[model samples]
Target: MGHSNVSNFVLAVTVPLPSLLFYLSFVQKCDGDRWENEYWTWVCDWGRLHPLYLVNVLFFLNVDILFWVVGLVQQNVWLIDPYWTIIPVLIAHFYSAYPAAQYDLLRSRAALLLIWIWSARLTYNYFRRELWQWGKREDWRFTDIRRKDPRNWWWKSFFVCFVSQHTFLVGITLPFYSIFTNARPWNAWDGLAFLVCLSGITIAHVADTQLHSFVARNNILKDLGAPTEPLLNRGLWHYSRHPNYFGEQLFWWGLSLFSVNLGQSWAVVGTAINSACLAYTTVLVERKMVQEPSRADVYRQYQKSTSVLIPWFNRSTLVKSKTS
Candidate 1:
């Protein structure tokens, strides 16, 4: 048990350390620094970079530490939760060489690899692009926090924002770890889980494609003397203001299939956390996407018409539809 606990801590630190170092190194260039920094210059700029990024990086890194430490105490298996496919899924499942020893490490590793590739691609794309924006990019959510607080409270706002994002990211991964560690031998549950997760990923891709296409067409129209405004209704988006968010929740919920116990003490809690995290996405990420007064009603109408997380073929009150 002692050994396992230590292993958990070490595992948690893996991604966090690299991410912290990478972001910190990159952010230093935010201030009027040139694209290139000499060896010693790197260290100096890091010392002078925005404390906001530093605080967030530390908070994220510590979260990694806390998870490993908690795994030790609760006997929680690290990177084997069996609930989420975000990060741990790839590490524990696809890379497990000792299939016979670990019971099905090979299969798990394959699944993990697939999930990791998909999620890593998406997350890196989203998070890194935001960082690349430098001051031009403000995570819209941060603007609200900044406005709600006075200028003097920027530090507190920074702390809150950084902690919230870090913690939320951690929560997103919790379900997968729970599933892998607790559930043994893939059963019928695995198929269900796979379908759900795949569905989510596929639909999210579709939504993103459609959104970009819509914008591109509008850009062309604008060039032709008409602006293509923000698309609130079209394709899957017409069904729900946020099909992508729904897909995200569905994917995590599916991943949780591996770890859930219909009656385990943590079973319900894990499910609830997975569900709540999706809700948080809707409230935090989706609601703020629009600002026009005229379109608010359309958004509200679409929200009422569509299923929030579950997919449906069309707008139906009896069932949730993904394709509308």
Candidate 2:
């Protein structure tokens, strides 16, 4: 066969192989009785909770390694985009399935529902951009990074890109762990948290839809060799420069609310760290936009008139900016 055919075969097999194995391993790990009967019982007995934590870490690492290897083969560091949306779903499901010594079925189920909603919407938005096929364009941010350090990017990406994101994924799901561990019954706080999370999901969906529509229209113009439109400054974009990012931050903070209600102060640490990370990300994204020759002036103008994260009453500012 040709080299292309060989590459295609490897791509098809390698992509799913690790995931299948990880799922099987997760299944086996979940079988507590089997672990108890095995020679590893001593290790399992050392700490009832330690083994569970260890398995969680191992499974995540398994997926993380597979993603990293796939990135290497594809030469596309954006391969992890889908995982960012999917990991929370996996974490919520895992914890909801195996609750701790004290469990609240109602709260657990509610939290799981909210997570699924957010995951489904976010993952759909991601997949809508492109099929998970090989040879597609990498995310612009990753492309920029790779361009900056052409020689060292591959190795640097292993630690800097994949591992760092994997760490964040694991850390941000601490709320799920906190929820599953506590026996807190469904209360007004849970209701409010759910509402906030649901609102965040809806806001993010709208913001993404608006952005997508704008990009599509601009891409059509560009395809016709026409000048592209300036930065989107309507709808959600009119109120906040990064409404979708704000929605994402809102979603995590809402999740963190559950932990706050449970008096698990440590779990809120995840939310705080995640917020800081997002703040940094927002800065990077805005800087990138403002540096783009085409987008720079328009984005700078938009930034001047719009809030950075919070959506506020900015119609007057928007109108004034547009007229000027």
The lDDT leader among the candidates is: 2
State model 1's lDDT: 0.51
Reference-based TM-score of each model: 0.58, 0.85
Which parts of model 1 are misplaced by more than 4 Å? 1-103, 124-136, 150-153, 179-183, 227-230, 261-271, 280-291, 300-305, 313-324
What TM-score, to 2 decimals, does candidate 1 have?
0.58
Cα lDDT over the full model 2: 0.75
- Candidate 1 lDDT, 167-267, residue by residue in tens: 55444544434444433665676667677778877777677666666766876998999755654466887666667666666666665565553122353
Residue-wise C-alpha lDDT for candidate 2, range 19-114, written one tens digit per residue:
456545544564475574564554444434653465356545655677677778777766566667777786676666541335688888888888
- Note each model's CA RMSD in angstroms: 15.2, 3.8
Give residue 3's error in model 2 in angstroms: 13
Clashing pairs in 2: none
